[model samples]
Target: MDLGPGRRAVPPRFVLPDVSEKNREGKRTARERLVVEREKQKAAERRRRALIVGASVVCVLALAAVVGVLAANSGKDKKSASDGPAVAPSGATGKDGLAIPVGKDTAKSSLTVWEDFRCPACKIFETTYRPTLHELVGAGKLKIDYHLVTIIDDGRGGSGSRQAANAAACAQDAGKFTAYHDVLYDNQPDETVDSFADDSKLIELAGKVDGLDTPAFRKCVKDGTHNSWVVKSNAAFDSGGFKGTPTVLFGGKNLAADPTMTPAKLKQMVEAANKG
Candidate 1:
């Protein structure tokens, strides 16, 4: 370009770069990179939290399952303890070793007498025919197999029947069963009164019979050694479908049920069976 006349020619000035604008752009880029890095960090933290919560739920469920199993096993153990094994007494005979024999095995006439110590009617029958039965037993004309039962305890609400029966079995163990048996009937408590449920009471009753209140007998009664055997005998009675206590059967006849049956008639039947 030509300058005006009388004016000195001047060179054109160059524009300098704007350093403030470049600094602002650099700052904006840095801010964008920082934002991206923060988003990545947040995503990683969320994944970690989810993993922790899932693991906690699994642990809790496993703990509950273990607790449930242990509780079930504990309940089963308690049940097993209460309902233990059925153990028969020493020298028990008959089906399931239930009968307690009072007479000799060689006797030809055998009498099946299902009796309960707590039964009022049984006490009556015992008192009425005890002498004749004893006479026949002493003469070796008849044998009596006493099946001790707990029907009273089953029907009524008391453990007297079972407890007394267990005591009688203890007497059998001590070889004083006949003496103890008579004593039990002679001093039997009322059906409503469960005095015989006490082991001390049963032991005291054993004092009436000689050599029946020994330590072994007392231990047998207290420890309930024949409790399982008594239970088994009662179960047999139930399955036998017999009527009730004092079910005296001789020669296929329920002698106790016979309206005209007497002690004389029993003796006659036994003598006849023995002769035959």
Candidate 2:
């Protein structure tokens, strides 16, 4: 239909949306978000790994510091061990300075027992033969001379063996050497760990013995007043031509090398020696 020029029909322009362009823009946005999230995760992992590494380094440093401190203390103890003056317990002591008598000097038979406080075999022998020794000594049939050695300390480095021997000497001064000595064997620490290196443990053992927990005993042990005596005792042990500890001698004859020397056999030996 024809219309006048002013009333002519106009054609409308339809603008279709660009769907592919919109899809491309959405994909680009998604890819950018994924990249940002991935970067965040990587940063978090880096921080976690850094923290773990830092903690490990700190632990290693602490362990090294502890080891260093322990080494320094061990050296200090060794150096101070021989620095001070030593005291001896009063008794009919030995000329070699190692023998501590447990029975009368005028007894009919003499039995000498050599022991290292750290020696496991010595502990067994002491435990097995204690009853026999007590009976013989009490009956005036035999006397005992205890020689303490520090072979364990010399062969394997630790203050425990020497410290224990020194404490035994202190106990001797308090007249409770035998009691303290037995207790020490009864509660002997493992051979590797240096539990006896602490003087407090010796004082604790002294407390087990009657009248041995006195201030004098404590001071003697803490000051290592018998350390030099322990040194001399070790020298005597070297001079005795003994190969190992638990050396038992009856009437100046060694009984340890005899396979037949049981506790019962030891008692018989003491009786026979007394008769002789």
Candidate 3:
């Protein structure tokens, strides 16, 4: 049998290629590739965000550590009143946290001390000579009161004055004003970034002194209830012509803001009051 030159016998049941199906497969593949790319992009974004957050946390922690170290190292060595007597807290709480002994309101030679908690000099005064003053107060010869101030060096986050005052207030409510007062001075922080505004430090400090309930102290600090007292004290300080801390007023007479106001000077002043 003759056949066309280009014709050949075709086999039965041969597989036919489906163009539309191939196109569908190609489209599916493209869709799957697009989905994978989107997933990769999302994962990359998440990783970037995590990295940024981690870096920020590291930086904050590093800064805080440095500040704490500097503060720890900057404090001047304090000399205690070795020859003077020790005093006890009267355990009195006034309208604010101002604690005064309850008795006949006799006019003793009083000293109104102006202090800023962030003031290093104030720390020295509080640490070195406060015990002597305490002795005098307990002995009914002298009365010492605090005038709080919060003047920041550059308006950075300086919570030294406020924290100290508020903690004192909390301690006052807990009947531990003097003890808490000493602790603040003892744990003075240096002038650095992340200074004294740290809530953790305040909490740690509160835990150290007895009679101050931690939860109550934290709430008081967060609410800033004692800020008004600090404000009033600052106003009083301004009225008294004070520019810095440790400005003592002996019998209402202004004393210098010297860091070197020794125990001898304090005793001499008290004795002079006794003579008069």
Candidate 4:
């Protein structure tokens, strides 16, 4: 190009690069990295959820298995307790062989006592009248027919009464019923505590009686041999329509209901009956 009249030639100018386009490219790269990070976080969260669900399912299955096993054991125990014929104790007598005689059969007067081992009142009655009862029984003037019942077990929700009564029946089998019976009343626990529910505890108590804690006795107790018998006895008690335990009856009279009755009076009554 020619300039007019002494115009100098224009020099070429250098062009700068577009800075905004470079910034836009950098922004696109940052966005891509952010999207990748978000996808990775979502994938990790899904895996974590799946692991939690799997662990929960395993725990539920384990719990169900444990419950099933427990239910099966419980059913077996029930069947064992109620399925077979009730075997009466050795030398047990009375209707359905329910009574355990504590005195001679030839006694002139009979005292029928429905008792529960876990009964507090029965314990009191035994404690109060034991000496007189022993004297009369020794003299052969009066006989006692003990009808064991599980009234406490029925009412208070425990197996102590039934277990103890079964143990007493086991003692009867060993021909040590009278002595072991006395021992039980002597060391009876509180009615509220079902310590006697444990067969081991019952066996321990049997150790107090001489020659009572034999292998046979332990086996009888551990196996619950007379549990069915005890259940039948309790059923008999329910049918009798008599009141609570210590239902002592002499000559068709409820002696325990006689508020004025005493040990001496009981002796006199037995003597009178003998004379009659």
**Overall lDDT per candidate, in order of appearance:** 0.73, 0.70, 0.54, 0.76
**Candidate 4 clash total?**
0
Can you write out model 3's per-residue Cα lDDT over 134-235, one digit (the tens) per residue? 777777777666555665322233456665665576666667766777777788776343355655676678777875756777776665556556555555
lDDT of 4: 0.76
lDDT of 2 by residue, 1-276 (tens): 011111111111111122476576764554464355345435644565666777788878799888988777874764245645445666737785568998877788888877888766566567657887889899988888888877666544577888898889888887888899999999997655678888888888887888999999888888788888787777777786775676777766677666446567777877887788
lDDT of the structure predicted as candidate 3: 0.54
Q: Which candidate is the best by lDDT?
A: 4
TM-score, per-candidate, Cα-based: 0.70, 0.69, 0.57, 0.72
TM-score, predicted candidate 3 vs. hidden true structure? 0.57
RMSD of each: 43.0, 34.3, 33.6, 37.1
By TM-score rank, best first, the candidates go: 4, 1, 2, 3
**Where does candidate 4 have its weakest 10-residue lDDT segment?**
6-15
Worst 10 residues of 3 by lDDT: 6-15
Model 1 Cα lDDT, one tens digit per residue, 131-222: 88999999988888898988767645578888898899889888888899899999998666889898899999999998789999988887
Give the runs in model 1 whose Cα sits over 4 Å from its true position: 1-82
